[model samples]
Target: MIKKAVRMKLYPGLKEEYAKRHNQLWPEMKKMLKDHGAKSYSIFFDPETDYLFGYLEIEDEERWAQTANTEINRKWWDFMADVMETNPDNSPVTVDLEQVFEL
Candidate 1:
C-alpha cells in the first residue's frame, strides 16, 4: 500500500457547507473510491487558511489514478467545484505532498 497526501484550498466561508456535503457524500462515490483501491481516506481542514489536507492509502498508484477517469469521480468533482479551487475540468487544484518522515 502507498500513503498519499495532498493539499487543496477551500473557498473562504464555505467550511460548514463543505463538511455538510461530505457528511452526506453520495453512496456511489464512496463505493467508487473503495472499488478503485482506497483502503483508507481522510480529509482535514484548517480554518485559518481554508486549506484542506487529504490523506489516503491505496493499493497501487496506477490503480488509484484510474479513478480519475470514472464517471462518478467526474461527477464528484463537479459536485465540489463550487467550494474548492478547481481546474477547468472541475477537478480540485491539488498539490501532492511528499513525506519526509514517518513514525
Candidate 2:
C-alpha cells in the first residue's frame, strides 16, 4: 500500500460544522473510497490556522484516480465548498505533500 498525505485550507470558525459533516459522512462516499482501495482514511483540522490534513493508504493508483471522478465525490465537494477553500468546480483546494521519510 502507498500512503498519501494532502493538505487544504478550511474557512475560519467552521470547525464544528466540518466535523459534523464528516461525522455524518455520506455512506456512498465512504463505500467508494473503500471500493477504490483506500483504507484507514482520516482527516485532521487545526482550528488556529484553518489548515486541514488528510491521510490515507491505497493499493491501486488506477482505482484511486477513478475515485476522484465519481459523482458522489463531486456532490460531496459541492456540499463542503462553503466551508473550505475550493476550486471553481467545488473541489477542495488541495496540495499533495511529499513524503520525506518513512519509518
Give the whole-model CA lDDT for all candidates, comma-separated. 0.96, 0.93
Q: Which stretches of candidate 2 lie over 4 Å from their true place?
A: none
Point out the worst 10-residue segment of candidate 2 by lDDT: 39-48
For candidate 1, lDDT tens digit of each residue in 1-103?
8999999999999999999999999999999999989999999999899999999999999889999999999999999999999999999999999999999
Candidate 1 clashing pairs?
A: none
- Per-candidate TM vs. native? 0.98, 0.95
- RMSD of every candidate to native, in Å, equals 0.6, 0.9
User: Which has the greatest lDDT?
Assistant: 1
User: Residue-wise lDDT of candidate 2 within 19-96, one digit each (tens)?
Assistant: 999999999989998999998899999878999999989998888999779999999999999999999999999999
